[model samples]
Target: MRVEDGFQPVPFQEDNPYTSDPVLPSLLKRTLPSSAFQEINPDLERLGADVVTTIRPLGSSSRVYPPRLTQYDQWGRRVDDLETSEGWRDLKAYGQKEGLPGIFYERKYNEHSRSYGFAKMLLMVGDVHVVFCPLSMTDGTARVIELMGSAEMKEKILPRLISRDPDVAFTSGQWMTERPGGSDVSQTETVATPTGVNNAFGPQYTLNGFKWFSSATDSHVSVALARTGSPKAGSRGLSLFLVPLRLPLLRSPSDPVPPATSNNIFVHRLKNKIGTQIVPTAELSLEGSEAYLIGNLNEGVKSISPVLNITRVWSAVGSVGGLRRCLAIATAYAKVRSINGGTRLLQDSPLHVSQLAAINVLYRALTHLTFGAVRLLGKSECGVADADELRRLRMLTPIVKAFAAEKACAGMEEAMTALGGAGYMEENGFGRIIRDSLVEKIWEGTTTVLALDLARASQDPAVLNAFLSWVKNVVSSCPSDLHERLQKPLNVVNDAVSELASSLKKPIAPLVPRPALILAGYVTSSTYLLEHVIWSHTTGEDERETDVEVLRRWILEGGMVPATEDVRRATQDTDARVKADSTMIFGRSSRAKL
Candidate 1:
């Protein structure tokens, strides 16, 4: 039977890590008490069962390194074949049956294919990172969600995707960033001119401008944001287009084949990067690429927000997984490796214990935050009452993206430190984890960019007040005993909000500078507040009684307030001090030279 026949897309489980036992899930449940934890328990258990049933245990010396090469090669060759029509069907059939190919396949392909790396290659070829674009492409997990939602699109693509049958993967490259734009959709410059369907051109758009970094250099399909109405239309003037990568075929092909003629899209060059070397980043020139609009003209950003929201959350999960892997490696090493006295490092040192404990706590908090977001997405998908949940998801996506990415880097760094000198070695995988974790900050969106976005969103009294009220409700609803544990940190957040509201009550100038600082403060304050609230809900105990009770106490005692003040003062003081020091040093040097 064809693999496609066996293909059954697994519904996304918020907490299903591919593993062979219920150990991880049981641990998570023991550690966390969020509603998401309860919701994800069944799925986690199912996934654990699936792992045991499917994967054969390789004996005790089976190396995690040099993963099964033939399987990896087969997957890569299949994807390569899909670049053409005849091969796409066969490959799609395999993918459909097996579900999304894991990172092992991705690593294998990058090693074998010297010409292009994962998502990045698409950018080099001027195709948006769709399926073919390894660097920028959303993984199979996300693609499955998108396919599930659109039966029409699914019907057209699933057969090919599942059968390993070749058909063009119509993954959309998101080209919304600009030179001065920091994830601000309103600041985009690419212009899309709608050309009414003509006998010659057919239904098309003439894209005129540059996109700094585009994914999937070979992807024939892209959803570009362009100015359609007014230059100042900001996001309102922006429109989305579903543009084909190639010119219209004179006639439809007898088989599923990408068109022969190239559209005007061209890759200027690929970006050099620190890690994720398998994925390519491309500079793109859209010198009259033929495109068609998707959704209403003015509602492009709105339509894309949901996609971005979902993808951002997925990215957070990926980062979490990476961090978990880092911690697991570090923990294992700590227990086994000997130190100064021929004792295991973990046993010999209090500092090591503290680091491990801190990492564990962070892992718990971040895992809960990420899983909670995933649960929110699942609940929204399953038609749970989530209007407010959706908004909360929106607010949290940037936070999760920013916070998790930052924490993942920090966590991995700590893991590296825990390993001492050995962590720096590339063979240990800590280096790779560090390199990979760097992208988490810049991926989806940067912290500073998201901070500004949050700040802007906060300016809208409605969004701001609603969010504040929602947080207030969450705080108020906590168990009475938990209130004592939460009250101090909660009060700090409340005070910050009140101060911000007072500042915004009147018109203010230099909006960019001060607002930026305020936004940072807001993210820090809100993140802690949300963390405390979620912890309160999930732990099912008063905050004072839980394991993170110390953390909560730390935040309340002086952690939250001092952190806020330090951020504010540091932002203002650091630059001026640096400039003054530089000036004084240079002047003294010149005088000495004279």
Candidate 2:
């Protein structure tokens, strides 16, 4: 007889991600009006099916074949060319042809268009090897150009940035991080020298400096921040520039191709990163890079602010997508994997299902929080937002970005744990999921940096008052019976809000920023869930029960407030805590003398 192998486990098969997710459709249904939902639902369905069948395979191939750089040609002349895999190229083509960026620009349904476009993103991002990273910058670049670019720049570049035709489309790299500073743009050292000359594209400059981190390095152009004034002028003295990464190849009339020229952008090296490896991130020296000024001089921060807002929203949505993917994998594995010596499937185990439920609950909460911001974005972009919506959008953008990312990191880890030993195996793909999710917490702004931004936003009386009033309005609108049902969790949320309000006046307020931001996220997300539940009841939709259940779970289980002792450590007893932290981290001898 032939040698027999040990018992083999059957491979796991994942259901179509769009159909398998119970929460997303219900969310779109609850958020969009009946007519709008009917109109966009079919597109969402198509993209959902394509995500698993087409986009995912391309994503896998991209990860398998990462990007590389060629610094010199065969004859030893400097070329500085970047090469990406066909799968990466195909994914980019698919995204462009599918109108990932065009959907928002088209605004076919007016303000609902962003929601429609982002819903497709929610379904597509998880399967696409973080290609959304470049797409995010591209969308941000388009938005900035639309709002701030010179008329000529807008007419020439904006359309291509958002074009649906892959051949005509362009992706943009955002180069903000520099060696001297990470998130602190005030410390940026890149300098731009005005050429004192106007090219066809408008005023030109020569930029010289090194960009520490340049994701989407393979992109055709970049929106960068460089000092045009005294270095001591800080961020206010900086100006935004559009830098071309490559020179157009001049083509002969017959050849229809031209000789390649340099834009003076030299890639020092591709980043060896933990995740998002499929995206070509690089360190580069901008040596006399040709640039076009965007907006007025000494207003770089203001010009780039819109781009940050857009990308931050992308980060939030992408974080949720990553968590969703991990959950999909874990959930699929649970059905096929056996336990109790093969007597029962893992899905049959209540404990296992509960583990999955915990992840699901967080995923649902983050989904609402992110999409709520997306809806506001659409309204703002369409010029239909009220003053209140504008302020809400400002505060919520940073909150959702930092909070969703931090929570999703933990949720993705839990999802991995749900898969047992198989999750640790690279072939199972949890490794890439977790690694990619980790970057969300750091990209744009880390949690600490964002917490400070939230603190600043709240300090503005108009912003804080608007948020508080909105919360009150949402709470007061609840129907009586449902209000009674939610009274306890609502009180929990209110209490946290009150604490935040009180802490803002305290001398230790700076110490409270992180906790304060956390409270804000909990409050807003809880409010969104509560609002959805009310809508579910009023609409009598099929998702009412699940909505209520998800709302209750999120309010109760999502850690609505910080612990009292933790608060004390952060605020009231900061001195003692610092000493303890120093001792713990630096050893007993390093503790400060009292």
Candidate 3:
């Protein structure tokens, strides 16, 4: 009568996130040279094999303890310290040693560096717990310093930020949000008053205000946006600053009193969230904190833009990682789990296989899109991008960020459901996958905001024209058979471009058009897949038939007619009562009446 004696299911445990992913390796082999593969293959394989020992403890127990804030000493002396978890700290060394950031900074593979770095990093995304959180900002921080910081600033900070030695390396925090603004930095209330200081660190600014959301609060340095001129000047009057959490030790004992260890940064509280609990996100107060000006004052928004572009790409990559993980779990679970009162295997179920394959098609399409962004990022950074490539990269960043994020949340949810009731359990990791992926949709920029950005960017004739030309080149080369399959989607995308061009002449109503933006993402992502499929076929060194099957299946899954399918889905919401009730939550005042 014991529970152990009864029927029990075989668990999908001890699988490596890196090794089990058949898709990433295939994509790498087809897109990159064998030498490129040789460089990354060892790292990927090592991460795959040793994953359980290295990252499992970090993942399974990471959220069990959230970060704690310590404000003072027992003697009542002010000593603000943010105490994080062991899992958070222990994974740092391994992450740094893996050289995820180093590869890009060093450009070991020349133009292929960023793609190589991202491909390696993407594989580690699901396994690293939320350590990738700080790493994203840290990578962005290093890039900002490299691009804009003064010679002294870059000399002093960039190496540490990209260092492989844990003792010398540093993670970074990005503090832009305040009480009044989220994505709207024009509403910033933080002020940076120049102290007329011309010291070694440049013009010293006494920052006084609150940063409402500060992820990686325990990091050694940060990039913050603060107002330098008239408050009414809005985002244009803002400036970017490099604030070291702990200043360099006062070169000599004779130097003016050294700044405190915390740089006057006080941790208010950590955000208690449903997921990504491994990353320490805190509310911070920056009062009289020392900071150095970076780039031209009042052009802060424009300067920090590069950082945004970098982080958005990271968010997109992370989103793909989460989706890939969920798919892995679903596929892995099916192979082992029995269904129908243990009479049949879940893998053999036609309904179950169809459900997974359908989502997998979407997943594959998005994978290509996300990696395409990564590849272009490498090309552009290496100065190999032409004018058209630059414009295409600009357009693709937002599309991938918005599409991958939104789709990941939805895709992971379906993946969980495919696992049956077991998916809902905290132990299985699906719950974490669903919750973590939700944040990507909001961070960097919400879907609506990004879609709006896309709408705005499309106003440039070059952006649209550049994208269409690239699409035509790829679609035109698709070997006729594949070209036949691509024609409908290509035609729809061409019409979208034409319509967008017309809309540019007369702006679209109430801007922020969500549907059109989403369709852009779908069209662009599918094109990326088609381009990649064509490349794989041309290479002759990779699996051509499998690539063809994947491309064929993705198109069959309704990827081409994104707008039509979206409209259909929207029209299917026929329940007026449910629709009305759904709005009640957002309509706080109306909810009371309901």
Output the TM-score of candidate 2. 0.95
Candidate with the greatest TM-score versus the true structure: 2
lDDT string for model 2 (352-374, tens) is 99999889889888888899999
TM-score (C-alpha, index-matched) for candidate 3: 0.90
Candidate 1 lDDT (Cα, 0 to 1): 0.51
| Deviation of model 3 at 173, angstroms | 0.6
**lDDT tens string, model 1, 438-547?**
77678667776766555556566665565566656765666676667667766776665555445433232223323433333344434444555455466564442443
Predictions in order: lDDT:
0.51, 0.84, 0.77
Q: CA lDDT of 549 in candidate 1?
A: 52
lDDT per residue for candidate 3 within 381-458, as digits (tens), equals: 889889999998888888899988877778888898998788899888877767787899899899889877877777
Return the lDDT, model 1, position 191.
Answer: 87
How many collisions between residues are there in candidate 1? 43
Ranking by TM-score: 2, 3, 1
Model 1 segments beyond 4 Å from truth? 1-170, 178-189, 198-203, 230-236, 246-261, 380-383, 481-559, 567-594
506: Cα error in model 1, Å = 6.0
Q: Is candidate 1 or candidate 3 better by lDDT?
A: 3
Residue 424 lDDT in model 2?
89
Per-candidate TM equals 0.66, 0.95, 0.90
lDDT order of candidates, top first: 2, 3, 1
